[model samples]
Target: MISTKRVFTSSPFMMLICGSLILALALGFRQSFGIFLKPMSLDLGYSRETFAFALALQNLVWGITQPFTGWLADKYGASKALLIGALAYMLGLFFMAKSTTPLGLMLSAGVLIGIGLGGSSFAVVFGALGRAFDPSKRSLVLGIAGAGASFGMFAMLPYGQFLLNSMGWFGALIVLSITCILMFPLSLGLKEKKIPLKEKRDTRAALTEAFHHRDFWLLGLGFSVCGFQVVFILTHFAAFIQDHNLPLTIAANALAIIGFSNMLGSCLAGYLGGKYPKPYLLSLIFFLRAIVITIFIFCPISQTSVYIFSAAIGLIWLGTVPLTNGVLASVFGVQYLSTLSGIVFVMHQMGSFTGGWLGGMLFDRTGSYQIIWITAIFLSILAALCYLPIQEKPLNVLKATMQPIDKA
Candidate 1:
């Protein structure tokens, strides 16, 4: 027989650890997609815009579907949803290897992988983890998982390079496809914990409350800038480094530095979120990002400078993720955490689509990335301002002013 008491003691933390490993598997491989830019575009006979557009589509599709994915995770079960997502992710990677045309690439890499990411990435797992822990510990749990996700970025770049060098890109994708199946085992651990929505409001009532909240939109807008800045840099920065006559190894190492630093940042942000206001932490992160980007661009391009910039930016990279979701959970509660957080993340995706597409389009047109870099600075400052006015309070604060709904 199963001991219910034993399950309570170890399971939540175990689920958090398992969720972290799963996120590393999903996001680590996804992060390395940037490394494929030069090789894939050249080999496929496609322009940078074509490749960029496909990735942009991927971000858009992920954003559009995330709410539904979150709803599924909440209503059915996150582990089941994750299992399905892992299969789609593996299938997407497998077909991406065989794709010869823009259409096939877009469908496989953009649509299928996007759906896979919507279910398997931090969005789904964080929701599951949020429910597993107490509200006070939510940020800490998220940070641990966020650090694990960041570690994927830390570990995957060099691994991807090794595979690229030895097995070739197609072979690398095939291997990665097989790697996606590992999520099934990890998913098993998450099934032990469940967040019953009956104790909280229904999905529609939560959605209705969130959509009416001013802070929700403000947070979403700020998150949009977060997506824009990071994805643009991730997608194009290495190529930009090469354009400066630096070594490819420098670019790769710089990326590794960013990832390595982010693990610490994710954890720090989580700790800070528990004590301080998450919106404030978000503002500080964006403000720092703007400063980092401005300095990196105007200064001389050298290997040391690249590493410094990478490390500085990396420290703040995914720090916002835990804090952002932390803020949402703090104010609204975790019952519909997945759905609400996913809705907010949609803004981030829209920004991702814009940032990736704009960088490539402007590069093809102007033969430079200066304009987009400047635009990022402007957006960062704007985002910092957007988070300043968010009122971090419970959704229950509105309960007195509104009608009660049947949670059952």
Candidate 2:
């Protein structure tokens, strides 16, 4: 039996707390980005696609750089990666406030913010936490960290709205930039001593092996749906609310509710993943997402239906993170979890790029979000089907190769 007291006192627990805080601040601000869309685009006289493209670029760059950032965290230390991430994130937000042209927005919000996200977000945080806990506790700990992020979403959305109302987008961004600086102090808790060069060789081998593995591709493909659906909602739901002639507060409240429900869902997923098959849980999640989305789209748009949909969908929102991480850690071990997870995340970000960009493009052309909504549903079902066949058992090659390293 696991001792609760021992788990609480361990050094890793401190690391987990700090890492969770980092995600909360980073992702919390990210969740509120849609708030800037109408205001920023209207003020700058840019089309929605232009703004969306910048955000899409952000996701693309984040995906492209994740492997390198993950490698940085795995090889150097999470502290170092997070420190760089904090600085980049601060600068990104600061410059984002000063930007006027499309090029400026793309450079600041797109490129710089992407670099910041690659350094500070889920992959780096999870890799560190995965290495800290044994397998039995990894999912649970990750769930706890995930809940922290959710809380940030829940809390920060309203705060972001307040800032937007009082200080304007520029001032809100400046304040948020200042908030990012807090991450530097938190990075200290996740400090890890550098690993030896031999382990770097092993990481390359693991990367090669993962490339050869069929399940790895499937995981990446399935995860892409998550990125697509979530990013679409986060980026465009405000506009969707406006199109329907609903009050903006409804959208804000819905997003906040999603964040709150996600806390419960993430924790539940972690607990369930430990006891049941992670792949099956993943399948069920996607299926439920499809069902919820289907119902929400078919029903008349109203405050009641929107809130209900938000609560229902929110329960499964970021739950995938822990379950997916659990599957990778279970199969490959944590020897180079960051590097491997980062590669898979590229697929997710690709989906994110499509969802963010395609939603705006199609909306601008068609004047309704119906096509994208249907696409999201289709992608969710496809993801459900994809996860069903994944073999979650540890790889034999990994067992043979990583066992010696574990002993040392």
State every prediction's TM-score relative to the real structure. Answer: 0.94, 0.94
Q: Which residue runs of candidate 2 sit more than 4 Å off their true CA positions?
A: 1-10, 195-201, 397-408
Off by over 4 Å in 1: 1-10, 192-200, 398-408
Number of the predicted model whose lDDT against the real structure is largest = 2
- Write the residue-wise lDDT of candidate 1 on 265-297 in tens digits: 999999999999888889999999999999999
Question: Which residue pairs of candidate 1 clash?
Answer: none
Worst 10 residues of 1 by lDDT: 1-10
lDDT of 2 by residue, 1-408 (tens): 111111112398798889889999888888888879999999999899999999988999989888898988877778888988889889999999999999999999899999999999988999989988988899899888998889889999999988998999999999999989899999988887642333334666888677777688889999999999999999998889877988888888889999999999999999999899999999999999999999999999998988999899999999999999899999987867888889999999999999999999999999999999999999999999999988788888544544232222
Q: Give the TM-score of candidate 2.
A: 0.94
